[model samples]
Target: MKRIVFSAMAACMIVSACATAQDGTGLSKKEKKAGWKQLFDGKTLTGWHQFHAKPGSTPAWKAVDGTLFLDTDAKASGASGGDLVTNEDYENFEFEYEWKISPNGNSGVMFGVNEDKKYGATYSTGPEMQVIDDAGHPDGKNKKHNSGELYDMIAAPKFYAKPVGEWNKAKIIKKDGKITLFLNGEKTAETTMGTPEWQELLNNSKFKTWKGFGEYPKGKIALQDHGDKVWYRNLKIRQL
Candidate 1:
């Protein structure tokens, strides 16, 4: 009878451990084992700060209800807001996040972002994973500007973004100069940087004249604030 009681207790403890691992806002047991780390703690903006803002300035972004969201009201009122960027720079890493955009919203996730004051904007250095309301945003009409594309350089074969207000999963992987992007479990774009093909694409794009665009091998990740409202959660990254 004592053996039976001990076995039941052990089973209950195992179940509890699994439940803790499956918490929505944190890395799962499998993810932790795979070397994934949370970029957003889901309760605070500890790991991020506004781009180009003075140190210790209050960020225009907010963390509420397990989401990191842009305060459009603050931005429209000219209350000190800009793109948010990670404090730590990453190179050759895989990043994953979930996002939901407001109607007609436009924003992006940029990687390889150089934070020097010389660059007026994040896009001047980093390449963006386009994020917009495909059905309402004007930019969505162009495949290259749609969500999950490599911004203006490489267009996705088809639209894979969910409707506005619905969360969509996005993944970006860069390893040894090769980059691949996925939207909602579908591969959206792939490219190899520092190649002739990459140069040709850059030369043909709007960033052709922008010095240092997509040239850095290591830089911070950025969340763009394009005068729109958007919510991001479950931001996690693992270095390759």
Candidate 2:
């Protein structure tokens, strides 16, 4: 009788814990156990928005063999604005993705991008996670242009990216005022948000000329084309 009462109490506690732990996404206990929510369905652009292109135009974003690929062949002359964004807005969260780039290609993943298209381009508003082929891309002329860096503003400690044509893992965590970048399971760069040093870096960056740069509190996420052939997979995010 004592064992039965103990089991009943434990079951009630588990139910209460689950009820309180269910997030806004209504994920099951098993799904939330991994602490990540899939941003892409791998089959369609369901929870994403394709902007900067024409109203009905879709820019080279297609799912092939379970990988989301950006085929820039359709976009010649480097007519930019091949940025796709998430439907949700995030302030403090953890992001992870696997990417592969063609030789000499260029691309980026932008976060904190509060969409004010009337103001200017995406880079002017979002902080970019620089994505490029380290040894092959022209932007890869230095450590700042390499993968897993904070895109021209901060440089990674070392080149931890795999060669072109191979998948490389990357992660980003934004907790409170701290932001960290990771490459291939190693921490690369980190900075405190809204600090004088960070503001100074922004003022000196290419985005300096643009208005409202890194001034948003929270915003949607964006994937940039930048006239590069890049592929992304297993993109996931977890809110803190």
Candidate 3:
């Protein structure tokens, strides 16, 4: 059934050369006016690819029911795959997505990633807007590692995460060297990168030893594959 659906979609793409916003996966008129772009087109991994996986490797990621999700079954069966990333890079932009995690699941959204030999994972060079099952996950015991926290460097003032299996809205805005994080309509974390204060925060954190960490001014956006089931949708990005 998945193949049939995708085959029809493939034919449509061949005819139209690309899917349109009418599918609810492409940029809407208003979003297009705002210079926003669609990162995932819901039906296919058009602008995305598996990270660190060798050529012809089966991707652990899957598009299902208009949601892109990490297929834990594939990983459990040892169908190896890594993080997922956008083909194009962005420097400063506003990215928004809706996500839902399985019980005790762990995942993250990373930006400013310099995907090179120097970095093994996106988190090695990019800052992650932490995503996880805030209530059921072991990491939830610490506010610093809970959902909406800036991974480790910064803890959100309040936990606004919904329960696992429920959709949550998140936004990460980076502009002019300043970054801000929003969860469920509330501002959670904000900081200026490359400043003495930012450097101090980095020095105090676990990433301090990685020489290339957070040094790049621009790079790609990525979704971490922590060997857990997590679904993402409505992925849209606009340059700031």
State which candidate has the highest TM-score. Answer: 1
What ordering of candidates by lDDT runs from best to worst? 1, 3, 2
Over 133-237, each residue of candidate 3 has an lDDT whose tens digit, in order, gives 887778878757888878888998888899889999999999877999999998888899999989988988889898877888788899999878999998999
Candidate 2 per-residue lDDT over residues 1-240, each given as its tens digit: 999999999999999787667454544565567677988777777788765446666557777776778877756634333688898989889998889988888888888887665845577788888888888877789647778899878887778988898999989898875789998998888988789988887786787777677778688888886877888888889998
Q: What does candidate 1 score on TM?
A: 0.90
Stretches off by above 4 angstroms in model 3 are 1-25
C-alpha lDDT of all candidate models, in order? 0.91, 0.80, 0.86
Number of colliding residue pairs in each model? 0, 0, 0
Q: Give me the overall lDDT of model 2.
A: 0.80
**Candidate 1 Cα RMSD (Å):** 3.3
107 Cα displacement, candidate 3 (Å)? 0.3
Higher-TM-score candidate of 1 and 3: 1
Tens-place lDDT digits, model 1, residues 1-240? 999999999999998788557566587787887888999999999989888888667666999899999988975565677899999999999999999999999999999999998999999999999999988999989758999999999998888999799999999999988999999999998989899999999998998888899999999999999989999999999999
Task: For residue 51, give model 2's deviation from the true position in Å.
Answer: 2.7
